[model samples]
Target chain A: MAVSFSRRIRSLAPVLVLLALCLVIASTNSNFLSVSNLIRLLSAAAIPLVLVMGATFVILMGSIDLSVEGVVALAAVAASMLVANDFTSLDLGFVALPAAMLLGGLLGLANGLLHVRLAIPSFMTTLGIGFACVGVATAILGGFTVRISDRTFRELTLGRLFDVPYSVWVAGLCVLVAWIIQERTRIGRWVYAIGTDEHTARQVGVPVERTRILVFALAGVFYGLGGAMSASQLGQGHALLSQGRLFTTITAVVVGGTALSGGVGSVLNSVVGVLVVIVLANGMVLMGIEPFVQQGVQGLLIILAVSLALDRSRLAVVK
Target chain B: METFREYLPPVVLVLLVLAVGAIEPGFLAVDNLLTVTADTMTLFLMASGATFVIMMGGIDLSIQGVASMTSCIVAALLPELGFAAVPVALFAGAASGLLCGIVSTRLRIPSFIASLAISGIVTTVAYWASDTRSVLIAAGDRDSFLAWAVGDTGPLQNEILVGLVALLLLGLLLNGTPFGRYVRAIGSQERAVVASGIPVERVKILAFTLSGLMAGLAGVVMAGRLGSGSPTLANEFLLPAIACIIVGGTAITGGVGSIFRTFIGALTIAVVRIGMTFVGVSVFAQQIVFGLILVLAVAITMDRSKVTTVK
Candidate 1:
C-alpha cells in the first residue's frame, strides 16, 4: 500500500512542478495569465502537440522516430502540390489531405520495414529515411515555394471554434484518439509489452514486428496530418516546413518522463510536458528573453528534468 | 576473404574514383582531385573525433554545434588575436565535449540525448556570440592559417596534411595504447570492463573530450577555408561525418573500426559529393543518394552479434 502510494505521489510530482512553474511565470509577467495570451500559447503549441503525441506512441514502443522533420517537409510539399497550389494545375481539394497523410504513412511503413527487415538501428534508419524525405521534398519543390489557395483547409486550421483555433481542436482530437489507443487497444498493450521486453513479449505470443510496424505507421499518419495542418496555418507548403521540430518533440516526450530506454510514460504525461515546454517558451518570450537564449535555457532544463525523471534501475546500459 | 573485408572500403573508394573519372575525364584532373581532397579535410578531422565515440558504443551528435561555436569564436577573435585564437577555440570545443560527457556519465543520460542537448546549448552560444550574423576575417589578415589551409604544401594540400596528421595521431592512440583497448573493451562488454577495474567513466569522458577537441580544430579549419564563420557553418557536416565513420567500416555497435578507414570514408563522400556535381546530378538528388548510401553501409557493416537487438 505504501509503495503504491509513493508511486502515485511520484507520478504527480511533474504536474505539480508544471503548475508551480506556471504560477511563477504568471507572477513574473502578469500578462502571461491573460485568456487571450493563453489561447495564443495553445495555438502556437498546436503543431508540436500533435507531433509529440505521435512521438509518444513511437517512444512508448521503445523505438524513436527522428524522421519527423523530413517526413513533415515531404508531406507538406506533397500536400501543397496535390491541392490548389501555384506549382501545379492539379487540384485535388479535400482529397489532398488524405493523399498527404497516405504519403506520410507510406514513409512510416518504410521506416518500420527498414528497421525490422534490414535490422538497422531505429535512430540510423529514421535519420537516413528523413534525409531521403528531404531530398524528395526538395525535388517536388523544384527551388520554388508552392502557394496554397485551398480555402477549406485554411479555414479548417485558422478558423476558431468556441474562441479557439481549429488547429488546437485538431490537436485535442488527436490526443483523445491517442489516449484511447494507448489505454484500450490490444496493439497498444503489445507496444507496452514489447517495450518492456521484446523477447519476453514475443514468447508470450505478442505480434512484436507487426505491432511495431503499426505503431510507426500510425505515428506517420499523425505526422502527415500535422504537416497538412502546418501548411494550412502558413497558407502554403515549402520543403522546410518541419524545421526544428525533431528536437522539440523529442525533448517534450523525454522530459515528460517517457524513458529514453522505453516502456515508462503516457499520453497524459506528455500533454503536461508539452504544456510545460510551451508555457516556458511563452513565458520566456514574455520576459523579453532572446530566442537563442531561450533554446539554451530549454536545453539546460531538459538535462535537469531528464535527470530527475528517469528511472535509473531501468537503464542497465546507457547508449 | 577476411583480409578482403578489411580492404573493402578503400577498394570501393578507388573503384568509385575510377568510375567517376571514366565517366567524366575532367574528374581525374590533378586540380579536381586535389580540390576533392582539400574539401574532405575538415570532414576527415570531424569524423576522426567521432570515430572514438562510436568505437566506445556511443554516438556524439554535438559535432556541428561544437564546430559552429569554434568557428564563431575563431572568427570573433581573429581580428585582434590572429593565430592565438586557434587554441582557445579548440579548448572551448574540448570543454563543451567534457560537459556532455559529464552529463552522460554523471546523470546516466544516453550519450546521444546528452550530446543533442549539448549541441543546442553550444549552438545557442554561437548564435549569441555572433548575433546571428556572419563574421569575416579581413583578406589582409588571412595570410597565416588561412593561407596554409588553402595553399599547396609539397605534393599535398596543407589541409590534407592536417587531416593526415590527425589520422596518424588518432591511429596511434587507438591501435597502440591501453586507452584504445579500454575503449574497445568497454564497447564490447561494459560489465566485464567494469569488473576488471577499468575506470570506464573517466575513459569515456576523455574520449568525448578528444572528439570535441577534434571538432574544434575542424571548425577553425572550416573558418579558415571559407575565410568567414557563420553560426550554421558546420550544420551540414553532422550527417556526413556520421556517414563517413560508418561507411569507413566502423561498427556502429562500437568495438571495431579505425580512424584511417574513416579517412577513406571521408574521401568516398567527397568524391560522391564533387563527382555528382561534375556528372550533372542535382544537389537534391545527391542528398537522396547520400541517404541511400548511409543505409547501405550500415546494413553491410552492422555486427548483428554485437547488437542483440537493433533499437
Candidate 2:
C-alpha cells in the first residue's frame, strides 16, 4: 500500500505534541490549565522563547549562544537597578530598557567580534561573555536582589489585554518580528543558505561574517528584552536565579523540533517547545511532583525530543 | 633537549604559579593548593578521558551528567551495599554514556546532540533518585572509596597522585595503542576509515565508554570530598571542565589534543578559580572572569588548521 504524504501533518507534529502534553498535564490537575496558571507558564516561557529564537539564528549558522544566561542576568540586574525601586535610588525612566539592551548587546558584540576577527570559536567567545556578564552583575549588586518599583516597567508586564498579560503581547510581538525577519528579508534567506552551506553562500557573495555578527547581536537584543521582561514581572532581579536558564532554553528549542545541528528550525517550533517545557514544569510543580523528579523528566524529554527530530542523512556517525 | 617539547606545558604551569604567587603570597598555601588540586582531579580525569574521544573528533557533553548519576548512585546505594556499590555506580555511568554513543552511532544523531540527550536522561534519572537533596554516604561505608580522594602521603596528597596516575595510564593508551590510531583516523576522516574496513562503531563506543568511566571516577572523588550527592552537584563542573580541556590547548574539533594538554588545562583552571576566591573577588566578578577566560583560553589553544569553521 502507498502511504499518502501530507504537509499539514508534517508541521502539526510539534503542535500535537504540545497539546497532548498539555492535555495530560491539565487532566492531572484542574489548575494546570487555569488562565492564571497558564499565564504564569507563558510568561516563564516567554524569556526563553525570545532567547531561543535568537539562539536559533546562531545555531542555524552552526554556532550557539551560551551567553544568554549571563546576558539575561546582567540585563535583569541593570533593569532592576535603574528602575525606581526601594533598593535603587536611580531611575533612568524609560532609558533603563535601552541601557540594559546596550550592555547585553555590547557583550554579544564582543562575542561576535572575537569569533569573526580573532578567529575564536563562537562557543568559547560566547561562554566567556556569559561568565563576564555574571561577574559584572554579581559585583554591581553585591549578591543582593534589587527590587524594581518602576510603575512604567511594571505596567508593561502586569497590564493585560482581554485578561491576558502584557507580557504575552510583548512575546507575540517578538515572535512576529522574528517571523517577518526570517520570511521576508534577504538576511533570512542568507541565514538558511549559510546553514546549508557556508562555503557556497560565501562564494555567492553573502556577507558571512557580518551576517553572523548581526545574528549574535540580534540574539543579544532578544536576551536583553527577555531579561528586562523578567525584571518587570518579578519586580526584582537576582543573578543566581537567571543562571539556570541556558540548558533549559537549548532543551526547549530542541524539543520544539529545532535541530541543534543547524538549518532546520523555526520560531514557531521554539514557541511551542517553550510552551511544552514551561507547562511541564509549571504543571508538575502544581501537581506536587518533586522538583527533582520534574528535572529528571525534563532531561528525559530533551533526549527523547532530539532522538525524534535528528536527521540521520547529514551525519555519518553520531560523534 | 628532546624533552623540552614535552616539558613546555609544565614549565608554563610553573610560570603561572610563580606569576600568581608573586601577586598573592597566599596562593602557595597547602590547604588552598590541596583543595584546588583535589577539585581539579575530577576534571583532570574527565579531560583525560575526553581527550581520547575528542582526538577522534567527537565531543562528549555527557561527562557532567555521567558524574552526577554516578555520584547519585554511590550516595543512594553506599550504606546498603558497601564497596559493591562502586562497580554498580561506575557501570551505570558507563552505560549511560554508552547509550549516548550508541544513539550517535546507531540512531545517527551528532555526538554533541546525542551526548546532550544522554545528559538529559542521566541527570533526570539522577534527580529522581536524589530528590534534589544532597545525600552523603554514611561515614562507615565511605572508607574505601574516600581513599581515592585523599588518605595521606609523606609530603604530598594522594588525590593529586591519583590524578597523575590516571593521566599517565591514559596518555600511554592513546599514544601506544592501535585503538588510538583508529580513533585518530575516525576523527580526522571517518569515511576513509569505513572504506578501509575499520569497525568505526566499535571504536566510537569504546571511546565514549572510557569517557563515561573517567567521569564516573570524577563523580566518586567529588562525592568523597563533598561528603554528599545532590541533583546539581556536578553542574558547575561542566564549564570549567570544558574550559580546562580547551585551555590546555586541546582543539575542540578533536583529533589532535592530548591528555597532557588537558591535564595542564585542568590545573590552570583550578588555580585561577582558587586564586580568584583567595583574592576576595566577589562571586559576580569571578563569574565575569571565568567567562572571559573561557573565550581567551579557546582563542589561545584552538587549532585553526583543524577547525575551518568555528562550529
What TM-score fits each model?
0.96, 0.89
Q: Kindly list the per-residue Cα lDDT of model 1 for residues A276-314, writing each as its tens digit.
A: 888888988898988877667667867887788777888
Off by over 4 Å in 2: A1-8, A22-41, A85-88, A139-142, A149-152, A279-288, B1-7, B21-36, B137-145, B273-286
Best model number under TM-score: 1
In candidate 1 the C-alpha lDDT for residue A39 amounts to 97
Question: Measured with DockQ on alpha carbons, how good is candidate 1?
Answer: 0.67
Model 1 ranges off by over 4 Å: B278-280
Tens digits of per-residue lDDT, candidate 2, A1-319, equal 1223454564577889888988888787898867788778877776777777777788777777878888999899888888897777997777877887777777778778888887876765786787677768777878788878788888778888888778878888889999998999987888887787788988999998898888888888888887888888788887765855777787888888777677888878888888888878887788787665655566667777777776667765445
Number of the top candidate by DockQ? 1
- Tell me the tens digit of each residue's lDDT in model 1 across B1-311: 44775899999999999989998898899987887888899999998998999998899989999998999988888888887888888999999999999999989988888898898899888988678888997776677646666667788888988887898899999999999999888888888898989999999999999999999999988988888887889976888999999999888888888999899999999888877887899887888789878988988887788777666
Provide fnat values for all models in the order shown: 0.65, 0.75
Candidate 1, B9: how far from true, in Å? 0.7
For model 1 chain A, the run of ten residues with the poorest summed lDDT: A293-302
